[model samples]
Target: MARNRKSVARLLIKAPVYLVAAWLLGFGFFVLTLPKAIPDGMTPKSDGIIVLTGGAGRLEAGLKLLEAKVADRMLISGVNPVVEPHELSALTGAEEALFTCCVDLDRAAPNTAGNATESNLWTQTHGYQTLVLVTADYHMPRSLILFRRAMPNATIFAYPVKGEWPMLYLANEYNKYVFTLIGEAFKPAPGDAGKQAKSATGTL
Candidate 1:
């Protein structure tokens, strides 16, 4: 009886390690599957930078890239209609005329999926060949899934904005990726996300 109890205790002690190892292995595989991160200082040659709203630093990152001439245009998706161009200009520290000339504020996208929808429309209309997508790092995985579905032929580049509390952000993103993967099973294939929030720009 004592021997059996000791065996059970050992198994219990090892079980956690086994589970952790499995999780790490799974995470590694997921990370490996992702496209390699864009190298630092190599300015992206894209038609425009698509900035998905919501994250703290994403807008700033997009603005910085635009200021640096990484792209000629900028699309700030999921913008509040109530917020005028001047307001956004003040917020982004860019001139209102510059925003009007180079920026597009889209209110159609209220979530990540909506962002994808609006983004696809904007990109398609503008005849953009390459798109530099800016979003929070944790949100990038899900963004890729939705964007791929939305614009399969477009050369989409991810410009992941670093976030505070990266560890927590990563944990949240991993869980979101899992949820999105599972959700994909029920969703229709790419280019058919009409009413659903399946677009890349949709909420996380």
Candidate 2:
């Protein structure tokens, strides 16, 4: 019994260390795979485009893609409620007509997860099956995870924006991605289609 107790204690102490090491290795791999530069002349068409706010140049990139006819519809997820479409066009230098007819502003999402939820609903509402997802490169991994969970049937293409981000920001995003992965692992399988549709439409 004494030998068993000692072995148990050793295992308990070593478990956390192993877990942390595994997590760090996974995080490093994720960082290494992130896009370092924006792709040029590689525009692939999709059913629509969804841009998650928070990163610089993301909106402009989305708009440019739309202008290039990459997709006919676009959603700027997580927009501030106060910002008008014309104001966004002015900021991005996109023509006002482009946004007036084809763009939607989603003010409901307040974070990456919320952006996924809101974009999923918007895609469903518009009958979109494929989407071009625009966000910062460091954020794309977590964003893709949540978006895939929220809309498993949709085809999502990442269009990561390259920018100068501080190390602290990258580290924080990495932690969030790790936490999200762990959380999703233990989550129960989603319910039927009706229930899922209702859940996606509701606020996160």
Candidate 3:
């Protein structure tokens, strides 16, 4: 009986230790896989570009793509509501005409999920099917997951803004990415989403 009890205790200790080891391994893989730079000699062009705010160099990265005609139009999501077009132009050192024509602003998105939601609406409004998604490298995984959930039918490309980020910041982002992965994994496909919404509305 004592031997059996010892085996059970060993199993219990091993299980939690194994779980921690697996989690650390997964986290390390996530960090290592993050893009360090856009590969050399590779140029990605899309019909549209969407920049998620609250990241270093993300806006500038997307704006450069837009200016280079990488995409015909660009959406700068999560802009401060009070910031005017001309002011943004001055801030980015972009020509006013560019904002007037090719650039669009979304002042409502309060977070990454909101950025995806707003980008989807802008996409449908503009009829842009292919998009270049720009955000910080550490943020790319979660952003891609949310973007795919939000715009499943659209063709999306990732353009990670490379930079050396703090380890704590990276860890936080990785945890969010893991949770997002779990939360979004079972979400119904795009077609099912539409039907679910319609059914709810009908019940109402």
lDDT of each: 0.82, 0.90, 0.88
Per-residue alpha-carbon lDDT of model 2 for 1-204, expressed as tens digits? 999999999999999999899978876887788966557668678999999999899999999899888999999999999999999989998889999999999999999989999998999998999999999999998999999999989999889998888878888999998899899988865556568788889956
**lDDT of prediction 2:** 0.90
Task: State candidate 2's TM-score.
Answer: 0.83
lDDT string, candidate 3, 12-100, tens digits: 98999998898899889999899766763354778899999886898788888887888899999999998898997888888899999
In angstroms, the error of model 1 at 190 is 4.1
Alpha-carbon TM-score of each model against the true structure: 0.72, 0.83, 0.85
Could you give me the TM-score of model 3 versus the true structure? 0.85
Q: Rank the candidates by lDDT, best first.
A: 2, 3, 1
Task: Tell me, by TM-score, which candidate is best.
Answer: 3
Error of 2 at 42 (Å): 2.2
Each candidate's clash count? 9, 0, 0
Which pairs in model 2 have colliding backbones? none
State the local distance difference test value for candidate 1: 0.82
